[model samples]
Target: MQAFEAFMDDLERVIRSAGDSGRGVLVGGDFNTRSPTWDPAVSNRRGELLERWAASCGVSLHNDGCTATCVRAQGSSVVDLTWSTPSLTPTVQQWRVLTERETLSDHLYITYEIRGPRRVKSGDGGGHARWNWRKFNAECFRESLDTCLAWGPTGEDQTTLAGLAAWVERTMTQACDAAAPRARTKSSNQEPRRLTRDRRAASGPHHDIEAEYRASKRRLRDSIKAAKAKAWEDLVGSVESNPWGIPYKLVLGRLRTASRGLTENLDSETLGRLLTALFPRGEGSVPVSQEDRSWNEG
Candidate 1:
């Protein structure tokens, strides 16, 4: 216990450094601690200490009410856990257990998705140029480009071909500069992308709906969070005293899913790859086979 406290103190030091630096934090693994906040089935001394540590650090536990992280003949345990700071909680769009995939360990696989600013493309950011087309005066631009096209020098034979080429390029570039092209998105002073969409697209009479829409969306997310916690609690209660109930529920879930259409509209190449296991590869085709199709299946 003394050694565990030392280790926890060291870990907290790193977490504190991350918070002070304003860097997002994500720490996840088999914690081997059980808490009512995360699993609801049980709570232990170490789990209580862990909660206190997180609260002191202003980090949120993300594995709330998640169960069956480790399953055995006797029962399932929510030993696997994930933790993130306040700066990171909003960025985690989804977090759940991967029940479809089973490992040699009693522990199940877990996954979480982070939704935030994508890294800027490296190596000169090669893509089509973006201009302030929304505010552009198209008529004036057309006249300017047309004048550039008409005014090329037929009399520049006095200069070298290279000089004439440079002159034309300079003229066109100046015109384009005057046209006010931009390379990045316009910054918004308030609200988010979705809220901005709601506000901007609102008509005069329907403007009141914008605020209501925002509130409704917030409520929906909160409701989902609460409902998931309750659902997991119910599941744990049902299976706690009956180990056989776990497999029964698993079989029923499989049956329900099997009744639904499993195949989606797939492009030819993707469809071929998806069906490769059931269908032999055609002659001359590259022998590429994916044993684990769980990449996007979840």
Candidate 2:
């Protein structure tokens, strides 16, 4: 019993390590011992060790195979049992004992119904299948102007057209004003006066301001490009990870074919409008000011 207990401890350690390695494990065998606490007649010292080991490893000794009395042979009690990690407890939907002859061993064959993680299916749909853009794009000021010019003849119609034209112009001006960058205020009316040659020599020559500005712009552009690339890579990785269990290359082919057919039927301007509506500019606007304070202030 002492030797058996030592062996069970080593076995439990191995099982625990295997389970901790992120893999599902099923460790089942005849340990030739029954819990003395449960059934005094058949229980032994080895049963105590097994129970302790099972508790430490969070293992469940499923009683689907053997009966309590089966520990003593002859009448043939259900002594065979199965054990598994705690994480796999929910997956054990059902357990059954098979015929002894089927297993070719003294113990009956135990079958486990394991429920693994579900696979994603591509057919799952219903979210926005198509997007629209133009609806959210600024109204066409140029188109409005053209419409006003085309309208003619009646004085009443002309007056209405002129009024619309004035409104469109104001809207266009406002849009331009919003898009333009704010002007920097001048620090002083006159530039700092140069000191005498010896005094001025103390300060180094003025830095190449234009060159630095150009370099900074280049760095910003590179950073933007790199960020965009990284974002695209991450998107691709996410799609690959949860692939919906469908061939992506085949889906891409189908999408391309469908797009080709759509290109002929859909107007370029209308498609652009749809895309604009799908991802409208200024959709996530930041507060222009907080308490009328500059953006730099908290």
lDDT of each: 0.66, 0.53
Could you estimate the TM-score for every candidate? 0.40, 0.35
Kindly state the number of residue pairs that clash in model 2.
Answer: 12
After superposition on all C-alphas, the RMSD of every candidate to the true structure, in Å, is 33.0, 45.0
lDDT string, candidate 2, 123-235, tens digits? 32322112123232344334333322322122332257775565455334433222232232232222343435545665454446656778999999999999999987876
Clashing pairs in 1: 38-65
Task: Name the lDDT value of residue 60 in candidate 2.
Answer: 56
Task: Please give the distance, in angstroms, between residue 258's alpha carbon in candidate 1 and its true position after superposition.
Answer: 63
Candidate 1 least-lDDT 10 residues: 149-158
Model 1: what TM-score?
0.40
Badly placed stretches (over 4 Å) of model 1 are 117-298
